[model samples]
Target chain A: MATGRIVIDVERCKGCELCLEACPQDVISLADTFNAKGYRPALLADPNHACTGCALCAVVCPDACITVFRDVPTPKAQVALEV
Target chain B: MATLTADITEKLVYQRPDALADLYTHYCPGCTHGTAHRLVAEVLSELGMQEDAVLVASVGCSVFSYKYFDVDAAEAAHGRACAMATGVKRVNPDKIVFTYQGDGDLASIGLAETMHAAIRGENITVIFLNNAIYGMTGGQMAPTTLPGQHTTSSPFGRDIKLTGNPIHIAEILGSIPGTAYSVRRSMHDARHVIQAKKAIQTAFEAQQKGLGFSVVELLSSCPTNWKMTPNEALSWVRDNMVPTYPLGDYKVHEELQSKRGRGR
Candidate 1:
């Protein structure tokens, strides 16, 4: 399975919950506390480690607050396989 | 299974496009104006036209659009964006000139200017935002407001007999001979959002090739004016707005038609 991570800029998030809806893995949720903007920011609350980092949340985000990254298999693993 | 760490070998998948300013926009929560701006910025960056682009921001909620885009931009009078864009494109024919206008400004007050620019084949791009209601003016009934839709001016629902009808800008503009490309897209869902981006990219390509006037009418939402949450407002656009303003390509020049259906 693809592994991934996301960074949410809390101050920039307006807490519209669009990222949560866009997260197919259901790994995102709104924080209980409010930010300086008085809006609850979305968090990468993945407990089962199920995030695939599809970037759907970032795509749907209107505020441009989410940054997404995907893990790449190490070259050492491919070298060992060839051996 | 292995635990994920921040230090893992990773590739960045998505981040803010360089064409957009690194500043907070004045748009409300869930306002699709930010989404539209982001898409435009992405397109400009992908086409490597950011340096040559000049944005003409129109009045309404998007009046501050110039502040959001990092490229050279100018603020135009209410309902005069097309006229100003025509001037800018004529003065600097080599530059990529475009106008960002709202329905009230494009279809209502500046209808004549918009049509004349298109009819003249001004070789400019127009990013038209149609949110149905006049957002900056406190949700008044706009020319694009749907029939029976309630607003500040139409508290009892808009009456078609009195207000006439909601204008289908894409279709109207597409019929003009000078219009090289005209299409309507929505920001209600991720799938449609992707399609909207493609349409925006095509509109810019039309201008880049000097095909003539191109406009992409984006059906956007106004959560504050609609008195609904951002998610609900998006659903409302899908359920209500999509029917009145159907999303499809109203026109495409024969040259551009060949480029359609190709994978990105």
Candidate 2:
């Protein structure tokens, strides 16, 4: 299976939480810490690589603070899993 | 999918549009102005019109649009964006010229300028942000304010009888024979945002091909002036605003579509 994640540019975020609402995977939330702009930036809650990289956050992000990346499952890893 | 992810740089699915500057804008958090600006910048970059575009910024909240978009910009007086855009378009016929205006500037003070330019069929594009309030001036009642909607000036809610009905600018402009394209789009959700971007792209193309005047009226939200949280404002636009300002294409010329090579 492919693993995916979202990267946020904290300094650019205004903590509007529009991305939090838009996230379908329920992986994003506002951090307790504030950015240079004095707004709490959005952070991904998933640490176990549960992201699907749907890019919904990027789509609704007004500040363009998010970028999505995915990890492709390798054939060797699949063979190891089968073993 | 697994084979593609091997390249790290290939993971770049989305980023800021190159047409946009890196500097920050002062718009309120969660205000749709930022989204609207991004849409225009993305479309301009997609069409490779960054250097050729001359943006005309009008008064009101959208006045800073010039600073946000990485292109030649000229600031227009109150409600005079279209008039200035007309001269800019006329002088530089080869350049793509468009005006970014808010409801207070477009439907109120500069109504005449917008109408006359549309009537004259000037080869220009207009991105009209209809937030239905005076955003920069403390949320006063605008010409597009909904019936019974309250504002700073209309503390008791807007009475259509007293202030007249909210102007349907898109429909009015669509009715003009000279208008090559006129459409209304919302910014409440991802679907509408995509549609809005497409509409903006088409509007710019209409001007690029020397088609008649074009206008893309975006139903955006002003969270700060509305006195609602950003999330609440987005919902308000989905509920209250969408009902009053239904989204659709009012007019699309055949010549313009043929150029884009699509029936829509």
Candidate 3:
């Protein structure tokens, strides 16, 4: 089954560590090296396969650097129109 | 299945609030703090600024405002909400910053910080809740308390000879050059609540546009402190407080322009 994904904007990330602590699925990890701003940005170790898209990480991020996209069921209209 | 009606409660709910330690609020029943909290939360949710917005919670009853608000909040010392908010906004210019303060915090102890922040035209919003009496610290007389009002400190009713007159904070703030928007409204009833919401939303929008300081003074009720029932407190606010405060726009940039003959 497909799942939603979490994307982090590394440049804007302030390395607040809020998302690192908030992600219940334990799929997010900090980068080994710091960015230009000298803060280690958050990254997804594994994609949505392990992410639940609960949006806890996005809510806790103080920099507003996280975005979540969830997979949706295909609309019936699309199937009917294709047929 | 029946179609569900989109209730006002649903629209006002905070969908994306931050998760900090959740402690039970210590507000009286029918207290306007809950409504005020919801208004701010709703605005943050609408603007998608909840993640970046940092609220400065003042002392007095609202000292624990950070608990109720679902955003990044920091507790400031008594009457220093404006200064704390100033530091936070200055350090992080991209974040939407605001201060939640009471009459005592803004008008009495923190008066200097509040005035200077307005004079400097800091790009922030100050949600000033004026309930006449201090709520958190056992109902003490505040700077904005009504004349002849009876409070813990003014047990025998505020004496004009001793307590002096009530301070008109909104009118005073409106006169400042740095203030971009200043509106005094109330939340006594549904009608006033609507107006209060509009004023609050406008202040938030002004911040979003990077405009200078904006303040919305809400005439709230304190039934527990006022020594009256909830309904009576609302009535007192409508009959007495509104007259002294006088609900209306005190200053507008367009008026300033015309007065300066810029339009002519």
Candidate 4:
């Protein structure tokens, strides 16, 4: 039940497509616009926001271009928020 | 769909390892050399051995490997990485010395140095990248090239009858009594990549304990040389390479076995 997202460093990504295949949720895709390096970089194209931030994409990323982030619960003044 | 939750804060789960340089590599797309380097950097960072580590960069596609790592490094002549590493480890004794080599550099030209180092029981780690072709030299055949596999030199496909079979480096090294640990792992998928990382960690640990020579032979990918897309090259490794070079620990020292528990 964890919500996660990933940021791809466009400049470093070579568009190898390993991340695309590695993503279990099929959330990543190649961008149409090419980066400065002329390579179409992978982007988080998750419409349903199904990413769980498993870091699998980053794990299989040969370029080490994907940075993964996950949402954490912050306990403070109790405000029951529905997500 | 609604869920009860507190204030949501984002935490970075994964990023580039500290030991790796913040610079672009010259490796071709989908080349697993970068993956192997990343794994080594992560291991060095995790073990807090960055400052005390010395990298011996070998010739080949990863010849500029030292520039990618933030550690004391030296460039060895072609196929002389293990021999150079022997000197470095002997001189420093306390430093963690390791070599990063390719198929041509290790299995072909450097075989003697590699075998002698292992036989001498040198306390050093070797990260051997075997992609089955001479990547830097325009994808020519290498000592580890698979049978019936086509390279520039083997345009008609490799003939095991004429050229002999692929040299199983890990198996040969594992049989050497001086080697503390020897294993072969692949980088074709996420699961296998993680397993490769673990094997690399174990190899380094073997060196850390002064056990002896440790080498982790990574069955990596070379998309450009293999004349296939990145994804296809990964599959090629799984379908073609894995069968030729089975993945497993060929040798694990008794002490390391005890430390890691039974069953790899």
Of candidates 3 and 2, the better by lDDT: 2
For each candidate in turn, the TM-score is: 0.95, 0.92, 0.68, 0.95
* TM-score of the second chain for every model: 0.96, 0.94, 0.87, 0.96
lDDT string for model 1 (A1-83, tens) is 88899999999999998878878999999999999989999999987879998999988899999999998767765455466
> Cα lDDT of all candidates, in order?
0.91, 0.87, 0.74, 0.92
The lDDT ranking, best first, is 4, 1, 2, 3
Error of 3 at B231 (Å): 1.8
Q: Highest lDDT: which candidate?
A: 4
**In candidate 2, which residue ranges exceed 4 Å CA deviation?**
A72-83, B1-10, B257-264
| Number of clashing pairs per prediction, in order | 0, 0, 0, 0
True lDDT of residue B58, candidate 3:
93
| Order of models, best DockQ first | 4, 1, 2, 3
DockQ top scorer:
4
The TM-score of candidate 4 is 0.95
What does candidate 2's lDDT look like per residue over B139-225, in tens digits? Answer: 999999999988999999999989999999999999998899998888887777877888899999888878889999999888888
Please give the range of 10 consecutive residues that has the lowest summed lDDT in model 2 chain B: B255-264
- Candidate 4 lDDT over B169-235, as tens digits, reads 9999999999999999998999888888888899999999999999999999999989999999999
lDDT of 3 by residue, B182-212 (tens): 8788766655665776677778777777778
Model no. 3, DockQ: 0.02
DockQ, all models: 0.62, 0.43, 0.02, 0.66
Candidate 2 lDDT, tens digit per residue, A1-83?
Answer: 45578889899899998888888778899999999989999999997667778777887788777888865556665565566
Docking class of predicted structure 4: medium
Model 1: DockQ against the native? 0.62
Residue A73, candidate 4: C-alpha displacement in angstroms: 2.0
Candidate 1 docking quality: incorrect, acceptable, medium or high: medium
